[model samples]
Target: MPHSPDDFAPYAHTSLPRLLTTAHLLSGAPGDHREPTELVRRTLVRVCARWRRIPRDDVDFYVRRFLVKEYLRGSRGRARRAKAQRAVLVLLHWEGLREAEIAQLLGWSAGAVRSRARRGLAVHGDDAEHLRGLFAKAATGLVPLDVQLDAVEQRGRALRRRRRGAVAAVCALLLVPGIVFGGNRFMTGGSTDGSGGGAADVAQSPTRIVAPGERVDAVPGAQVWLTTDGKHWSTPEAPNQFLGLTDASAEDTYRNKYQDKYKDGYGSGRKVSVESGKPTVSVQPDPLNNTSYFLSGLYRGLSADPARVEVTVDDHRITGTVLTLAGSPGWGVWYARAPLSPEELKASSVDGGPTVTVYDAAGKAVARGGAAE
Candidate 1:
């Protein structure tokens, strides 16, 4: 049988006060209170539509739980709603709602609600006490009740305004450094290679060398490639050398060339050690060719310069002149030759093998040659 209007009227009227009170408590202040009320009204309307299925005992529980869950989930705006909900919870606690009932009303576990309530009380209880004290003092004086209430409301509004201003100031302070750093990077055209070009371009270009101990910015769109010769190379065009590419044979050739160059000691088995802080080096080992090559380095800050790197192996020191060219940052392709003599290899503690070092744009060492031991 269809329910008559009178049959639903009592439930609707009785539910109104509960919903309004809940909304008001959640709303924080007059300026923020209306929205919570509207939200509560809508939620209740939806719950009521399903009233037939909900047991009479559970209807209030369900509606209250829904409001609490919505507030916790922060469906509206977290920052604003969270503050309002905290204010509301404070009022509810003061009204003598037990921790368990508050939990049910807020759609949180009872323990969680109790913990949060305790913390909230610790933070706001003093203010509430002060307000109550002010009201009590006013009540005992000649001021009218309405006038006392008005003064309390004004004080609360002022406090909230001051708190909001402090929060805004803190947010600005935290964001200023990020804004400056980002703006400087953006204005300088994104690459800090010291040459004012993209970091990837500087890395890939045969002509470009990252100076030692200099910072270079990363290129947002740069692609890096590796050759078995211990050189970090970059290219705008996709080099056929990447994994699963069509130029597998070309990559094999490049790998073979490095292996052959290092097969017998070429530069008295000399090895170069490179490291860096700003640009990071990536390598891929070609199992078939027994070689690994440079992939890419993301450059940043003073670590962008390549010339600051030091390269040395055994007794053969990498003179500063050679270091200047060989350690230039960005990407470099280096070849490590086998020991010139067994004695030379033994002296360097290498087993007839070679080593390579990669340096960042800032001349800070970033990577070392593959372990041969």
Candidate 2:
């Protein structure tokens, strides 16, 4: 029942770009010469081992999905996790996956998928029409196909070298006297945080979500435990404060983005809203103490208290966490307390830079607005 290298030949030949592209994204090295290869090298080992289990119905689907998951496995933090999800969405969409289909595969509703993709690709909207363009091109322009293939092969060599190095390390460890335990930990990639993923582990530091419109430093009785400007600190509470984790108004963000679209009949018959709501973005508290803060916003002109709302800003997409049912009668509210920082917002705030967009539960465009400066 063991599968052979022959079983993976097809994937290498046809999906090389996707594999390389995903590796590049996950590694955060779109231009790196070696990271992509290392990722491909590692992924191929998994694929070959599991070849027999890969579905016969759509080999490409399973293969590509597997690649993304493998990359995510090595990634660190919730922010990185969200980034990985966004990259996967854009990459898969770039690879011709249908909006609804991608949504289902990723555990997202069809509507959420559309909204995420639209915002992620808002900068690439023009080029997206040409489906035949390679996925790598979307991120790094057209990398030569041969170059991609070369990286895949290079990974094998690097992995073999790593194995030999690991063995040498183990041999050295045996000769050392009192350092055995410490050496073993190092070899296994153990870390001080205990998760090996890094400092962002939620177990070590839980987020203190400020309520919408509440200043981070102004949390009642909470002194400055964290700070970006060095002068200001969130609560000194280890489990309570973190910086710039997104605070949004589910309703305001929606209204600011879509109010104008609806009135102009952007997708009139299909229910597109251009109505401007001018949603206010803030870092606020989650009374439940679950996340950093609800990135909450109140928006006007929602279509039928949408079952879901998707908010995309900067490089992150947040699905509504708490919804206020028509609090202002005709207003729709949505919010998510993200772990992102205030510095992170500056990247999305430049003119013609990234903008925030909101979508209805059905994947229809509700509204969009520029990121606050």
Best by lDDT: 2
Candidate whose TM-score is highest = 2
Give me the runs in candidate 2 sitting further than 4 Å from their true place.
Answer: 1-6, 10-14, 25-28, 76-78, 123-373
Model 2's TM-score against the true structure: 0.33
In order of appearance, the predictions have TM-scores of: 0.30, 0.33
- Candidate 1 Cα deviation (angstroms), residue 64: 1.4
lDDT of 2 by residue, 1-373 (tens): 2234465567666767767766665555566647667666666665554555454444665566556666666568876556655655555555667764464344344456667666656555635655325444546673643334445445544665677799899988787864754565445652321223432221121223322222222233332221111111223222222222122233243334444422322111111223354332222222223233334433445444433344454456555532332122234334454554434433333432223344443344455543332
| Per-residue lDDT of model 1, residues 1-373, tens digit only | 2233233346655665555554545554434545665566555544444444444434555566555555545555667545544744543553446664554344334456656655655665646565445333432322111112233334434555676799999999988986976675555553323245434322322233433211111132222222212222322332223221122243334445455443443223222222333333222222212222222211222333344222234544221111112433344433222223434433444432333344444434555433241
**Lowest-lDDT window of 10 residues in candidate 1?**
212-221
Model 2 lDDT, full chain set: 0.44
